[model samples]
Target: MTARVPDAPPHRRQGFGAFVRARAANGALVVQPRMGFSDPGHMRAGLTATRAARAHTVGTVTLDSYTRVGDLDAVEPALRAGTPLNGYPIVTHPGATTRAVLDGVAGPDFPVQVRHGSSLPQHIFRRLIDLGLDATEGGPVSYCLPYGRTPLASSIAAWQECTELFSHARDLGAEPHLETFGGCMLGQLCPPSQLVAISVLEALFFRAHGCRSISVSYAQQTHPGQDTAAVFALRRLCAALLPDVDWHVVVYAYMGAYPVTEAGAYRVLREAAELAVRTGSERLIVKTVAESRRIPTVEENVAALEYAARAATDNTTTARDPGTDSQTYAEAQALVEAVLNLHSDLSRALVMAFERGYLDIPYCVHPDNRGLTRSRLDEEGRLCWAETGALPLGRLVHTGRRREVTAAGLLADLSYLRRKMDREAIGAPPGTELTGSA
Candidate 1:
């Protein structure tokens, strides 16, 4: 039997979705950092700094690993031992402690979203409910396949319950907004069509489970033109399918293979900001220049936010591409339609799509994933599928001379963006390929 969620009174408080929508309406692109710290004081400071930056911004309370995996016991001991966690441990930290972190920083103007890579997020949702937080980002497939060995079935069931739990936040006068991490599956190498399909599917799942406000995500891929088309396709599909829901598109900075040099890192971020502006994406999740080395300090995150904002401002006049007839749009629409036809329920359709190989992620090793699909970076730096496996691309699938992705080829593809950006930063000749030397 399908679980029914009771409707709550309309939330008067403008939450994350409304905050992003307002910024978009004013032609301001909202930039956010992936910043979190174990200490509540540091976390609060980070949020405060983010809010104070020149960029139109949002706050993030990314959760630590132990808490993400549901091992709450390990968080306190590590906190007491002075060992720094990769992110804030929201579950272990008392509700009052988290409230202190967002006390003055997060509110109507500055909304914060919890980003935790968890397959099972019931406890996380419970914690967010208790803390009066209304926005969070993750998808059953995105969180499970990339991060761990959790079965897809288990993740789907858990997420259904979690979405219902999160929807209850509307009762507290805060609109519950959930962002789909599906477009970022495996971070990189997956084709944009699959990314778009999964992101839309996840947003539909959230809606079916009682969420009214949602965001679809797309990470910056290898090629700017391709990434722009992908985002446009995402926005178009969301508009057609989610007619009554309050939804937006959020683009993440290139999520794979950070550049080793600071110059290269900043250059990549600048391009990401330009992409957001060019594509008319409502919000962007920015990565710091310290991404390749260590966890970024609050200061570094602030600088990144400022830099991205400046880039967006400079590129505000760039013309938007109408991707209605683009190959990306056609392929993505095909994928989304194929899945929707499988079952009336979005969750079951997603599971069956993977099971039938109608939807496949390239280079993902998850057991539930059909590993037959393969992708390689083309000479033009655009991601192309070497093999489509069983994806329902129809005439869109590539039929060229396919080359196996050797270990050397894979390494080169991973470093393709970093090397290109670094050379550009140093004024190297355009189209000069790196020879693997510093």
Candidate 2:
């Protein structure tokens, strides 16, 4: 049976969605950092520093791996032993502890979103509910496949329940905002069409489960032109399908590999900011120079945020409109329609779509994934489907020259940006072809 979405009240202006919309309306791009600390004092300090950065910004409480996988026992032991965790242990931390972390830092001007890679996020959601944090990002397939081995069916069921639980945050006077992580599956090499389709489909799932405020995400891919077209396609799809919801697009900086050189890192981030501004994306998730080496310091995060904000301002008046008739848009539309037509229930439809290989992510090895699809970076550096598998785009997209992506080819593609940017740092011309380089 198709579960009807209950009527949601008018959106509150103080919520995360409204805050972002209001900022964007005033000609500001909201930049955020994926930062979290196990210590409440340190987390609070990070949030405070983020708020103090010279940029229009938001804060994030990204959770640690243990809490994300629901291994609370491991988290307790680590915390008790003072072993530093990679991110915040939201589930293991006390409610008062987190409250202290956000007591005065998180407010209208500085809304915070909890970012955790979890398919079963019930424990995490319960804590967020208690803390009245209404903003978070994850999706059934996006969180399930890339992060762990959780069965797709189990993840879908868990996400549905958690999304429904999030929807009720309105009763606590906080409007719930959920961002789909679908566009960033496997972080790189997946064709933009599939990314756009999955993002839109996940947003639809969020809406059908009663979330009224949503944001669709897209990561910066190999080619700027392709990323531009993909973001435009994502926005067009959302505008058509999610007419009644409060929605926006968020651009994540190059997610696969980071450049070793600080200059290269900044160049990539500046490109991402330019992409966000040019494509009319309302938010950008900033990555710092330390990404390729270690967890970025709070100072590095602030520097990246400030720099991206500056780049956005510089390009604010020169936004481009890619229009809706491109190949990316058409392919994404076909994929979304194919999935929706599979079943009346969005969750069931998604499951069946994967089961039948109608929606496949290239290079993803999740057991639920059909593994027939493959993608490669073309000579122009745009991601293309090397093999279409059973994605409904067989006739729609022509794989001009099919080449098997060998192990060496895959490694090269994975490090494409790192090499290109590092070369540029050493006075190589911009946009140099990176065909064969060590």
Candidate 3:
């Protein structure tokens, strides 16, 4: 039996997606922080601070690890023992208490999103629905593969049910918005084309499951030019494929290794903001100076938010167009077409694509992943696929006798940006040459 969705006031409040769209229409980028606390007072304070920052901002309630993994039993003990969880345990917290945390903080102007890394988010979705929140971010494939050993089939089934459950927010006169984490697959080392393809596919999946408002995500990659091209590709594909759905593009700060130095981290974040502005992305998820060392404090998050806002203001005045004819767009379009041709349903096609190696993630070791594709950074610091495996790119990829990646070479590639930025933080020349598989 299907459980009934709870009733709430028909409050006509503008959701997170609408708020971002309005900001984008006015030439401002919405900056958000990934912050949550085990204590409600602290969470409330953090939200208040984020909303009051000197920038266009949104609020985030990132869930703790125990809630993410579905181990609700561990939550009570941790709370009682006064041990700090990494984020807010939403499912374990009382609904009224959570409401109190967001009181006067989350509204039409300052919208909030609940970000939980849960493959099976039925309970989390219920909590959000009960709390009258209408925005969340995650996808079955993206949340499952990188986080744990959850089977892809099970994750997909869970997400289908959860997506339908969350879509009922419209009944209460609020538009629910979902953001796909697919583009950040494996976070780094995966090439841009596949990332773009996955993000579009997940947005399609959400639409199929009754979500009308959605956001596509892309993480900052090795090269700035490539990243710009990738965002353009994402926007183009979303425009072509999802004409009926209300969608926007979101750029995530480099999700890979972070520079150890404060200056280096801030520089990378500033670059991300500039990328968002140049690509006409509506929103940016930011990282702080303490990203490499620890979970940042509320003050650090505010600082990062303000800095990104300033960067966006400075860069958005002059926009640059990454042409649709770029290599990234061509490759991404081909991948999207190949997956869509597999089946009428996007979710089924995604699973089959993985099984047949039609879609592959580089350096991903999940059981569902084929592990056939490999990627390396080129001389110009662009991520290039060294081995394309069975992806239906035809002549789009040209590796020409792939060479094995050494342990040292892999380490160097992983630390490429971190080392380069750290060196530039002091007085050192920029390193352009990267360690390639060849």
Error of 2 at 24 (Å): 0.6
Query: Candidates' TM-scores?
Result: 0.95, 0.95, 0.94
Q: Give the per-residue lDDT of model 2 (tens digit) for 1-438.
A: 011122445665478887887788787899999998888888999999999999999999999999999989899889989999999999888888888889889987789999999999999999999888989999999999988789999999999999999997786565789999999988998899989999999999999999988999999998988898899889888888888888888999999988877878888999999998888788999999889888988999999999999989887644455666788998999999999999999999999999999988877888999999998888878898889989998678898778878999999899888888877866777665433222
Which 10-residue window of candidate 2 scores lowest in summed lDDT? 1-10
**Predictions in order: lDDT:** 0.87, 0.88, 0.88
Predicted candidate 1 versus true structure: per-residue lDDT over 83-103, tens digit per residue? 999999998888888888888
True-structure lDDT of candidate 2: 0.88
Where is model 2 more than 4 Å wrong at Cα?
Answer: 1-13, 317-319, 429-438
Q: What are the RMSD figures for all models against the true structure? A: 3.9, 3.9, 5.3
Q: After superposition, how far is residue 379 of candidate 3 from its true place, in Å?
A: 0.6
Stretches of candidate 3 off by over 4 Å are: 1-11, 317-320, 429-438
lDDT per residue for candidate 3 within 279-385, as digits (tens), equals: 88899999998888789999999999999999988875435556577888989999989989999987788899899898888888899999899889999899998
